[model samples]
Target: MGIIQDITNIFKTKPKKEQDKAAVDRREKQDALHKAFSDIQQQRLHGIISTLKELSTNEEIKANLKQTRHYKEFEEKVTDIIETYNRKLDHIDPSIKESQKLTVLPIVEAKLKELDKWCEEPTKTDKTLIWKNIGNVIKHSLKAIKNIGNKGYTDEIEKVRYYMKAVKNAKQNTKEAKEEVRGATKTFNS
Candidate 1:
């Protein structure tokens, strides 16, 4: 029985060439996206990455942000907000990866989930509120940064303001790149 199963498994598995091709395809897609994002945008994406990093631990969550029954709605709302942010980022730099930047809504949801888990603990504190506030600031920062094309940064928290400026810088870089492309495409006929 073992010999027969081994023989079947060998035939079921895909060959190395096919797997290699798939891997190459994935890399090409990733590179294409990365190439579309300019150097400045990439720099901004990497810089200030810490601001978005999770600060709240599971042990910190004293209670759920909402009732268990509302998890679905909470999920949808988080996803919508994240997708909106991603859309704005795509406008600024198509190559930028929100997931890696931890700007993705899913990452935010995961942090919230950790908060929920902490909420399960009998003992509770203000940490839940703090995490929620931080999450809001993060989301607001994304929205405000999206507007940096015209409005620029606000005089809010110093850390968030710095990241907002980075967003503006990225937008400026994208704008300049677009102008350069337009200039290159323009034709002067004799």
Candidate 2:
């Protein structure tokens, strides 16, 4: 009966990591959307500048506009949009630089370096010891990383580490799958 129960547990459906997947998906989508919007805004500003340049180039149009009452209003409106977009562009660069700097994760980097140094020599005696070693690594990681924002959820370091762990597992699985596929391809071609 215990053996049957253990077998059932082994085949049991695990809970989905909904938060982790949603966060990664949301961040990627938001970044792509912001880039697209920035591109569109840049194009619109360039189009406005081109229009203003054309207005300045034509003698008749310039003379007529200078004589008209609406010319000052038109000039002000166009100039305002140009200045507004200029200000927007100016503000964007510094913020981007700041955010890029914030993604450093200093403590995380240190811990990763430590792991690299430790992993340089194989010290595991058995399978259980290897699993315990891995758990300790994760425990230290959770403690080392205090916090990381930018995942759209300003969650704890533990949560962020969970996301990274999930990604690492996925990447490992993908690499193994590719290797298997390549091996199979060679066999089939032969």
Candidate 3:
């Protein structure tokens, strides 16, 4: 009877141990998954910041508006956007996984350099010069997006459209102002 009782007790203890081990493994896996998700989210946020910086520094965007009446207005708008985005991004944990930073940093740096060049001299009198430079910047931005292996083409294209509209509006306003001056001169001469 003693031997039989001991055998039953041992069987029960083994199952309880096995159950505890399995529960621990499950918890560990859950924690790992959560960590991975958090890391991915951070990377995406960084990508957003990189894209915004590229748009801010794009030379063609700057050149189109530089001499326009709305130049300051547009600059203020863009600056605000960048500041707001940066503030939000800064709230993210600063600790980034090493592998991710290695892959993301260089592409972001290159994009930023291109943007800085654009901002330095936003526009010149040469129509073709401004558009051509802008086209090149857009191409470079697209390439960076590709290198990052993300899907932001639509957003990027929208950014191009925004600048294009600004250029077009500036040109129209300049034309209207010239016409107004011409009318005033004709009246004065009469």
Candidate 4:
């Protein structure tokens, strides 16, 4: 009985070489799919960015907003935010092995969506929400840095920290500028 069972098992099992070849083929197919998906995601991100750029320079928005006392400052800040967002996206290394970029992508997409909405409906109260979205991007960035095996000391990590710090400073400067604009408006109105 044992001999017969052994014979049946030998006949049922695939050869080791065939199994290895199949595994390699499967992995190759998976990799190709991943690469194709990544390319699509990259294209979508570019489109969003281009849309944001156009919104930033939107003639109607510009015409409506240009009458404000701090319109120039607002325009500059919007440009700065867009540039900073681009920098943040570009700072991500492409060679990360674990699809960390994909994990970060949705967060970036969400931030861009928020920015798009904010651009469409410009309001002073929404600045906090914009900063919140920016903060989420920065937080996800830090997570990406950590996931890549950096001990929070690499040049990449430092640059992310610097960006975080720069954002803080920008927020502060924005508050001060807004106050000044308010004071100037009050004086002009009086």
lDDT of 3: 0.55
Could you tell me the TM-score of candidate 4?
Answer: 0.49
Instruction: Give each model a TM-score.
Output: 0.26, 0.33, 0.39, 0.49
Off by over 4 Å in 3: 1-14, 67-71, 89-190
- What value of lDDT does candidate 1 attain over all alpha carbons? 0.46
- Score each candidate by Cα lDDT: 0.46, 0.46, 0.55, 0.54
TM-score of 3: 0.39
The clash tally of candidate 1 reads: 2
Q: For residues 37-117, could you state the per-residue lDDT of candidate 3 as single tens digits? A: 556544654654654555457675565547555457435644654565555445545575433434444444454555545
User: How well does candidate 2 score on lDDT at residue 15?
Assistant: 36
Q: Per-residue lDDT for 54-87 in model 2, tens only?
A: 4444454445345434446445544554454455
Q: Of the candidates shown, which would achieve the greatest TM-score relative to the real structure?
A: 4
Give the alpha carbon lDDT tens digit for every residue of 37-100 in model 4. 6665555444434544543575644544454444565566556656755676677776773365
